[model samples]
Target chain A: MSANKSILVCRCAERGLVDTDGIAGGESVLVIPDLCRAVADGDPMLGGAFSEVHACHPRAVQSLFRFAGHPLPDTTQVIDCRCDGAGHAALGTMEDKPPAWYPVIDYDRCSSCGQCLEFCLFGVYEKAPDGRIRVVNPDQCKNNCPACARICPEAAIIFPKSVEVPINGAEIDDEAAVRANIRVNVDEILGDDVYAALRARKQKRKALLNRKKIERALEERRKCSGGDQ
Target chain B: MKMEKTGVHGIPSTLQERDSLRLRVETYADQQGLVPPLSMEELRDHALELAPSSVSVDYVMVLLNNAVWRETVASIPYERRLLLLPQCLRDFKNCPAEMDEFGLLCEECGRCNIGELQSLAEDLGYVVLVAEGSTVVTRLLDGGKVDAVIGVSCLNALEKSFPHMADGAIPGLAIPLNAGGCIDTTTDVEHVRNAIRLRSDASWVNQVDTARIREMVEGWFSAIEIDSMDTRTEQIAYEWVCGEGKRWRPYLLACTYDALSGADGIFPEKVRRLALAVECFHKASLIHDDIEDDDEVRYNAPTLHCQYGIPVALNAGDFLVGEGYRLIASVPSRTADLMRIAVENHRMLCVGQGEELRGLVDTPPFTAAQLIEIFRRKTAPAFGAALRLGALAAGGDDRLDAALRRFSESLGIAYQIHDDLEEYRSGEEHDLRASILLALANDQRPLEWYAPDSPNLDHVFREMMVEEKAAQLLEHYKNEAIRALNPLASAPLKSLLRRTTSKMLTPAGGRA
Candidate 1:
């Protein structure tokens, strides 16, 4: 929760992602015309990490660093300046966002089982000729959904913007990965689907946004479960 | 850097060229027999191979999904389909359109094609959504109100929505905008026109009045939930009856009766009594299951034991069991026959639960086969009773009862496995500390079973393909459930049973 003065701002003017003068340039503040192109072009300016990043969404910026082979540490804070500039006095979150939500795979954890590939409907994942699975279309991922993560079996899939842990790049535990019982877990999700018998069942589950509470409860339950045993 | 409206854009900008590209994609799709939900890489790879180098993958992906879903979309009746248009298609400055929760309310303004397409689609009974994003589209689909969708959107929007349609296996065709920017994007009107008018002989399937039948069942149960009760125990029993249930047991009974007798309108009084009996049996089991498992919550609320003490909850459960037998015997004409069905299922349920409960003994390690046998007695009999009672009420023969028994066993076992996996995954409280996943894992690798909360357990479960093996077992039983229906000569029962498999088990249940 402490602040860092050294900030990098990506105007991202090409897609109108941020305001041209959202920030009043200072000695520690560096303003790039577009961070997206900078990442794509392997700009040397991105060689080091920044404690504070004034960009679009925190997730988008983190994803850019993740894909660019220099993942931001959990300590870094990203402030969205698409609507209002990340002024030295005020660094508010991006209120109006474009479609930048996508999934990032932890290849170390992926087994190429193709479960995520079969589970996804949006064609976000693909199987290579070598049988390795890859996130093919990250942009097509639904915002705030970590369903693929839930069914990953390996807990490899992460939604950078997700409010849930493990899914949000935190550590996994019994609460996040384990369930009360396999049958009960399946029944909870599937039974919720049944109640909405008239609609798309999984789709309802896909956009279930109040995940922070459920996951927190899961964590507490896991610890208690361990203690009770 | 905005382009002129309806002029500058990439990827087959001309209507003629776009149409030709659509034709080529359709031909290529036919050759490959490509089924969606197609992965982005697959769609991109196929599009690159087929379309000219000038065409974009975004353009081709839309066309590719459209080509594959063309037949399916055509089969869905216009009433069950939605024609979605973007507001950017409107000449917004002059467009006289209002918006609603569903979509744009068009004023038939001549300035834009939004009016034209909306009018044509609405004429054919297609639900029209002239809006941005797909929240409403998702809601309509989730509600099971619409089965198919035809939409014109920018590639970016289509990319986001593709998965929802493909995942549900709901047929859809999307046309990407070829000209202009987001303010006033332009799509080929001909493409929109053709998609709107799509129709075939298979456009609809005639069926009984199921929506109304569900309505009647829901209405009756709701009334019973709040009906005046003299005793506190009766009040508690009825309150539990209507709480957080799909009323599947009763619904199955009604559907079975309908299929057997071909009754279209409201059900008779005798059938309703039998239906209530089926639910009483199910709810009673839940109360007991809660006490046994010590689960604090059910149906997203406090369990009966949690709400009341275990003693009162147990009494209410027993009361319901007695009520079930009483309901079945209320009609004296078929009391003996119906009572036989009720008593037998009740005994089977007790036997099944008895095996799992095991008379307060220490937890026993169970083989996969033994666990499944428990499901046969614990789960299947209730569903079998529901179907059998409906059939008996409709004057079905014993031959039908035999088929129903086989069908329910498969369905119940599958349901149990499904519940088994979900409950395990949920980490909800349960007296049975065993898991099918752990059992399957132990069989595969011969590892000592770890406690449920161990991180190593999950890793081992994943490493040994625990979910995959269990899913296979689940799928096998579902198929077996379907096969059991083949023996029935009754067309209505057979057809209803076939659809029931897909309806109940199909969600996130691969290949259901």
Candidate 2:
């Protein structure tokens, strides 16, 4: 848990994965946004969703590098420009493959509800305090850009087709430009509606709050049930 | 009886018999497991004590004449009707007068109200439509999908809908707009909550199917908890007042939604679950009532305290309250909010208990008006909430919620008065004998009754008969009950309810 220890280690704990390689004495360890991909690409015990993410993790994480997976995740899937401030960023061309890193965003349409945050396991966007979303570390994104735009209540958030916006008045790589336009995380951009729904649903379930505690006991009972076998 | 180890497939069949036998044996606990049925006089005496007035007696008889209400309910296939009350109109907050204005007529503001109603429609759960006007109603019903309706409206919409509501042979309950025409108005919040509760019925057929209840009770005998002291307490509680009670509160809700949607047949799971919950509440209240009254017998069996100790019995009631609510809250999250209201209503029951207790000696000279207020606070909320929650569970229109509130309030007062008259006549005390009605009624009579109790007060019983003036005092209270019901708009259900109310309005000697 040292400052020098990568955040990936922290995220690994959050995602319920057991970390066997405990920062062994001064060994050089490459940082990657996702262990799911690192495990799936080279290691065993993961498949399907990983097969899809192996293609898109690298290009988005411009600052940090992930050695385990492919070069970059399809940035086209992480569409909202607000997440990346200066619109679509380019990461050169993967010729004969239609440059899988097309960036998309439609700002006027987004109601900014953070269902995408819950949907994304890869911590692609970080929610800011002022109710806007920012994508500070896109390198953590593991290809399956689910947090980008799957289901929005108001149909407010959407992916913009690969369009290029000028960043710093220079036409850079579309994935890079997309990366530079990092104003907020998708959740902060669409925070209110999800917050309201969560609040309402919570209030209604208040009487059963004790049941939640009971559920812990029930869980213990369930575990014991397996032990009985 | 030899315990049979039935196979899994055969478990359900035997479970039913087992539960039925369990109920029976529990009833006969005092007879050492040979409970003889109460004689006709015993039933009449109990019935009369419970329902002395003509109205109450008739209501009981109607319930007793199970053939009638059941046939009436059965013949009417479940139907649903939806009256999109003004609350559905998002802009309903705009105008002061245009809201669910205690008057009928709704100004549709075009919002999520219609969307919610549409989803209900698509579920094929019921026959539902946005009722913007009276003319549209006929066409809506002409499709013949709805047998009843849950309406949302001010008094104005109700005025327009009532004729169509009646024209369609539909049983409908209105969910009125909150106090102001607004959906989120503070005054309307409780009104909306109550109305939804009243309109929603446990739809016993839908969720907690008979198959499941049988399943849960299955293997229960062999289960670890069956013979425990707690189980015995529940058994004793269930034995008393376990016969022929219509889950009117829960069913009213299911019926309201079905009426609007033109759905047929009660969802077996819904009503079964609702019945379980409602009956638990009813049982819990009775346990406490018996404790307060100091009665030892009910339904011709020893009361909870008589069978189990008082402390255990009280805990048993609380356990049921908790269990009943959990059963309700355990439902899907979609209807979780409605279940929460069911739990909150238990607080209102406590309020009624407190009022009843405080009234025992607080000689504030009870008036008919005051008693009516007490009954409204104590009883109407439960009855009204029962019907509303069912409709809400089905996601009925917000408009009819208000109208249903008024309807339940009226019906509740009528029932309370009928109860007072019955108690006045039966003079049968099982427990909690320091009756509020008895005391209040006696208060209104001439002081001469307080004079040395003539022949009636002789013997050790003379002190008990000190309140002979109760019969005369009940007469005035009955009028107050009628007045309470006068405000709501008319419909067949209202008339039936009124008839049920009047049936219990007889003189102490079965003479109307």
Judged by TM-score, which candidate is best?
Answer: 1
Residue-level lDDT tens digits of model 2 in B58-175: 2232122221112222333333323344433343324322211012222222333443443443243333333323333433432223444455554333444443333233344444
Chain B: TM-scores of all predictions? 0.61, 0.45
Candidates' DockQ values?
0.03, 0.00
Model 1, position B279, has a per-residue lDDT of: 91
TM-score of candidate 1 to 2 decimals: 0.50
Candidate 1 lDDT by residue in tens digits, B5-124: 554434786778887888889899888766544544566778888868777777788889888777767877777777778777777556655443333555655788887897798778
How well does candidate 2 match the true structure in TM-score terms?
0.33
TM-score of chain A of each: 0.46, 0.25
Candidate 2 lDDT for residue B459: 39
Per lDDT, the best of the predicted structures is 1
